[model samples]
Structure formats: structure tokens, C-alpha cells
Target chain A: MKKLQLIASMMLGLAAAGSVSADAGKDTYTKVCAVCHAGGIAAAPRYGNAADWGPRIAKGVPTLYQSALKGTPKGMPAKGGNLTLPDASVKAAVDYMVAAAGGAKAAAEPKADAKKEAKAEPKKEAKPEPKKEAAKEAAKEEAPKAAAAPAPAAVAAAPLVQEGASAADVNSFNRLLKPAGKRNLPPPEDGIHDPANDGTHALQPPLAAFGSLPKSFAGNRVNWVEAIGSGKIKPRWDRTDLTAEPIVMDMNVVREVKGSMPDVVYPHKQHTQWLDCSNCHPAIFTPQKGANQISMASILLGEKCGVCHGKVAFPVSECRLCHSKKKDLVKPATAAAR
Target chain B: MRKLLTGLRGGLFVGLVLALAAVLFVDIQDAQAEYGDVVINNHSDAATMRPVIFPHWFHRVRFACKVCHADLGFKFKAGGNDINMVKIIDGQFCGACHNGEVAWSVENCNLCHSAKPGTPTQVHESTIQKLAQPSGASQKK
Candidate 1:
């Protein structure tokens, strides 16, 4: 069966090289569909796996095309997550996969005939493009109903996409700070937790629990540092050891800048509170003073202090936050005078 | 007339300085991910999903770096490992912990694939290039 599938794919590839439509199907499959379909991730039907594709094929070819184009709630992203792909390309890829699975000889036969016709008469090749464009239009009309049908009940109830807002409208960066209304949803309603999991539904909603914790302006709106300091939340220091405690160090490393900007004061107390010594040791920073050549550019690019500041910790927008210490002007001038 | 030309030039210099300052201020505002955030786009963009934003800080706080880099065979370099959904669901890379037993399973797609669409796979604000070269070599450049 595996050998047969390999021979089928090779034949498909050769046929794809002969014609534009077949070529697109194979190309789209290789580029987009293969990522999950090739491996059957999250129950996605594996290419050429008869058992996996059997039940799905029973649902019919049009249904399979819909699943491939619109995506399934099971995990498949619509158009294999590339919205830029034309509907015809997506349908061709779906046909390619269906053919490879050996479920639809009827669907595969026309493609083979098309390949032969393309070879015999190159002019006829232009004919398919119009048909494909027409298919694209038909798919566009069917898209809304197919998209609306399979939306999981939980997704519809919670509605991660705000009302009247398209998917593109949502900002993807710096997810730490959510809008006030979106902040602290229940575990299942929150996009992070799996609604299908019963355990997720049982967990406490963040809004209800975070009410007593220390408040901050950014990220989930809870000041983790202050919360830890005030003993509001005690995050485990180790994954396995229940009794393990963090070895907190209350030290500060002050790095002087060359320009007029104030010197940066790195507080070990805050960092050590959450991380172990090895996390940022020789790999990220050398222990000795003035040993590490720190710069604003490196940090901005996501190095050194940047590894965390703009990501999970407070962002670099608070310049005065890190660059807290004022430089001693008289001492430098006096040393220069000498 | 000669004095007027010098005054005009002086005014232009001040305007340029102010403009430069404004640009620098805007640049700072656009700083990338919070520290230790790795954006894995190895396939997501082409697959039509947002790039995966792996929160290094969130993971490190729970388990040491050795747990992943040392035990799990993850290289220190960003995008160094060929992580795919198949390998992850099959219990490799992120799957080792992200499996329902250790953490949340792979069902929550948007949670990790949370980056803005078109975000490339990379270590957010990667200093790896700078660290790879000697301090003197970078300074000379």
C-alpha cells in the first residue's frame, strides 16, 4: 500500500509538471497541505492512509473540499492557514490528497485526462484557467455557509473575535495587555484554555481570582512583582519539587551609558525572584562587572535584557523604569582634569 | 544678507535635530516581543496561521532551561530546531511538556499562534548574531 501511494504521488507529480491546474494542486499540497495532512497531526487525515481517509471520504468529496477550504474545528486552519491561496488552488490540493488516498478514482481520472490533453494541445491549457476562475467564484459563494456551519459551540458562545470585528482587526503583538472587557475571562472562554476539556471548564476564571491580586497597567493587568512581594501569589520555583524555593538575591548591577541617558540599573532582586541563577548566567551575561558589553540596540533587537523585557516582563516603553540612576557628572570631569 | 543666511541655516539645524529625536522616540515604542519570546514561523505563515509565540519566561519560571535545552535536545539558537505540529503532537519538542499531563494540550491553536499574521520565524530581537561574533569584531564593524 505504501509503495502504491509513493508511485501514485510520483505519477501525480509528473502529471502536475505537464499541466497548470494539476501542477497547482500538487504544488499547493506540497507547500500547504503536506504540513499536517502528510503527518496526520491532530487527527488530520494522513495522505495515502486508507483507514484515516475512509470515514472522511464517506462524507463525500464536496464535504472534504469544504473541510480543506474552510478548515475543521478539529484543528485544521482554513485554506491550510494561508488565506492568500486561491480557492481553485485549495480545491486542487484537496483533490490531490483525495486521489492519493485512493478513495476517488472518478475525481483522479479527469485530472489524468487533462494532463494528456495539455500535452497533445498546449492551446487548450488556457481553457482550464477560465474554468478554475469560475470554480473560484462558486467557492466564494459557498464559503459563508460552510464557514458558519462547523464553528464549535464553545467558540460561538465565547466569540474570541469581537462583534462586528473581522479576524484581521485583532492585534497580535504584545498580548500581555488585553482590552478591559476581554481581560480575565473564564478558563474555557479565554482563548488559551481548551473549551472541549472538562478540566478547563472547572478552573477559576481569571477575573474572579485576580480581583484581590495587585494591579498593574500592562499584561493581564496584574503586577506580578508586587503580587509576589505582597505574598498574593506564590508561583512554584521548580516543576517537580513541591518544597523547592527560589534563592532570592537582592543585588543591583548598574551599567553606565556613554550618552546623556541615565545609567541602567539591573536589579537582581526582581529577576532572581522568578528565575534561577543559571537561566541568565554565562550564556546571557557574565558575572563580573563591566564584563558584558550591553547596548540599547542589542536589547531592542531582543538580546540581553530584551530576552524578557518586551515579551513577558514590563516592556521597554518605560525607559525611566530601567534607566533609573542619574550619572555623577562632577566625578568624571574631575578625573579628566587630572 | 550674509548674517541672514547663517540664521536660516541655524534654524534648519534645530528642525533636523527635533525630527531626529521624534524618529528615535517612535523607534523605541516599536520594540519587539517581551524578553525570551521566540516567534516560530517555520511553517505557520505558509500554513495560513499566525506565527507561534513561545513565551520563554513563562516556561523558564516553571522549569529550568536545562529541562528543554539539555533534556529535550532543543538547541540554544532560535529556529534551530525543525519543530512541526506532527512532532509536537507525537510527543517531541513542546509536546514533552505541552501534553495534557504536563501542560495544556495542542488543541488551543490561537493561544500560541497568537503573533500578528506574517510574523517570521525568529528569536524575537535575537542577539544570537552579536553573541556569535567576538566583541571586538562587532565593535570594528
Candidate 2:
């Protein structure tokens, strides 16, 4: 049975593609159907000519659908070569044709009334009051500007360095600043100094990284230079150009790491403004060198400093950035003692 | 000796011609770079610089890379070599971003087409006035 159906469909498909049934209703009818059907052109049947279509009307709806699906014995091309038309369209055209052929029973069935009955039968009335209540609740929920107010508070609390702070203060400054302008590139306009003006709560920059701002300087923040490169600190992403040409940092060391020559100061805030702290903190130093088992051997072998310095940032080839002093003179008297 | 002299003269003539060509080519290239995408000459005139420098870094911070590149569909490279002021004012390439919300609206011609580089503020005010004006002299006709 399935095989027979398949054969029948295939036959219909072939007939549809061909140019038979030119005058008989189906086939590629829409493009040309209106011309003749709207008016009896060249003795063609008028669209609503039930008297003329009475004989064809005796045939069933499915048969007419098939006829439209597969062209008649005339020169009409099957399916109109308008592959976009679905079987449903063909069925509607068949219905129209059948209705034209005096199949008034199918046409006058009052489909709209039936559809209305099917959709309208539930007659819902009980739950509307609850929905209205829900709407009112939603409006009430939306009334307060509470959510919007917190953003300014959040911005105020974000890590931004107040002026005249230590290296620690600089770190908190960056953290606070990071959240304030999540999407934009920093240092933000108004120059990362003023607090955001949304009125959620009183705002202040994050607390300083060091214990307290030195008494010598009451309110001045150290320049970005002192924060990162000072005290033997080495910054990260030195090679990565954030906005323009690579910056060759000049740092003055304030402290020395043990067993390590004086810590070549790394510029913290300047580099932080360019890149995030995660770019260096763990992989590069791990808060402190010995905490992560970092060694000069690993560094020289392209592990840490070797990653950028020799290749992109500035080659360790200019040795002074790290080893600050020249070799001591070997005096002749000292040589004799040796 | 005659052949050598002839060769030297031929080489000198070729060298001089090539040298002149190279100089002209370099100047032309430099001029192209100087005027690269300057559609608005008014701003250029008011500012000390002939072309108002629309540096990428200056704008990229506020707008996302994708906002101009993807949403507006600007090509990654600069100096399309064919971008025109009329097309911009009518809201084709750069106008998509420069439309009032993002940058200065390009509807006013002198805002960008100004050839003077004097006071940028004065030029900006004049451009705003021009934008506010009703289509005037031509309307009388």
C-alpha cells in the first residue's frame, strides 16, 4: 500500500511538473488562473460558473486537490515552477475550484464560526483578577529605584587610588577603578580622580595598599611611576601595546629583595592601567618570588623576564634595567693579595 | 672611450629622470597621507593642522571595537581612499557612528569639510549654527 501511495505521489509530482491540464483547474494555475478565472477568457470557465463546473463538482475534494497538484491534460506546467507553493495552497485552490463547481456544501460550512467555537469554548473569567493583581504587584515591584541607586555606591566603592598614597594604595586604586568603567578603556576621563556621581551612598577610593599614607605627604598620591616599578617590582605585559607605541619605563628602586640584588623597581599603576593584574600576579611573581619558586635560572631560560624583554619589550641586551651597577674595578694590589 | 662616454650620459639621464620621479612620488604619497580621510575641511581649517586628526585611540575607548567595526561595519583598515563627505552626511559609513549619539553629527558640511585650523571651538559653534539654520538662500529661489 505504501509503495502504491509512493507511486501515485510520484506520478502526481511528474504530472505537476509537466504542462498538461492547461485548461483543467490545477497545475501552474495561480499565475494564469486569475486571468481566465476572473473572467471567462477564450471560452474558459468563469471562476464561479457552478453550472458549467457541475459535472466536475461531482468529483470529490481530494480528487480536485490532486488535479490541481497534477496538471490537467492541457499545456499547464506542473506546480507552476514556483516550488515555494506548498500542498496546502494547492488544496485551497482545489477548494475554490470545487466551490466554483457547485460544491456549495464544503464552501458554506461556516469554517469561521467553527474556528470561533473551538477557540472561544473555554470562556475564561476566573483567573483575570489574579493576573491583574500580578500586574499591580509587578508595578509596585518596579516603583523603587533601588537597583539603579546601588550602581553609584558600587562605583564609589570600586578600587581607585586617592592622591598621595603608597604602592598598596595604588593597587586598591586599580581594583576600585576596574569596576567603575567595566566596558571602557581606562584611565577614565576626569582622570581616575573624581568619584562617580550616582547617588547611592557616600563614595571614597579603595583603602591604600600600604598601612597608611606617609605623614610627610598628607593628601598627595604618588605618580603611577612609583607604584609599579619602584622597589624592585617588575610589571607585566610590558611588550603589549595597550594604546600606542611600547613604553620604556624608567623606575627608581626603593627596596632590595634578600639574596637578590636591589629589586629593580617595576611600574605598577602605569602597567595596571594598561592591563589587568591577573596578567602577572600568579604566573609572574605569585605575590612574592620565593613563594612561587622563581629563580634567575628559570628567568634567563625564557621562563619569566626572558618572555618579553629579549624579544619585544626591550632586550635584556641593555643590562642596566636589572643589574644597576658596573663590575667593580680589580685593583693591582687586590690582584697581588689574591 | 666614445662608447664609455655614451654609456655614462645614458646612465646620468636615466638617473636624473628616476630621481625626479622618485621625489614626485614621495611628495604625492606624503600629501595623500596628510589629507588621508579628511572629509570635513572646516574643522581642518580652524585647527592648526590641515586635517583634523581622528586618531583611533581617542575614539576606540568610548565605543567598542565591534560597535564601529561590526555593528556599523567599518573596514578594519583606515583610508578607504573613496570615503566622501556627501556619503557621510547622508549617513553611509562613518556617519553611522558620528550620528549625534556617538560623535558629532555629520549633517553639517563645514563641521568636517572646513579647510581652516584656527579655533576649533569657533568652528564648532559656527557649524552648529549652520546646522540649526533653515535651508535658506536656495529656498528663496
Tell me the deviation in Å of residue B6 in model 1: 70
Worst 10 residues of 2 chain A by lDDT: A121-130
lDDT of each: 0.57, 0.34
Please name the candidate that would achieve the greatest DockQ relative to the true structure. 1
Q: Cα deviation in Å at residue A220, candidate 2?
A: 29
A123-238 in candidate 2: lDDT tens per residue?
Answer: 11111111122222212211111111222222232221111112212343222111111211111111111113221012122221222322111111222234333432232321
Structural RMSD, model 2: 34.2
lDDT of 2 by residue, B12-59 (tens): 334334433433332222111110111233323333433332422233
Number of residue pairs clashing in candidate 2, backbone atoms closer than 3 angstroms, sequence gap of 3 or more or interchain? 50
How is the predicted docking of candidate 2 categorized under the CAPRI scheme? incorrect
After superposition, which runs of candidate 1 have C-alpha atoms over 4 Å from their true positions? Answer: A1-211, A329-338, B1-39, B44-81, B85-92, B104-141
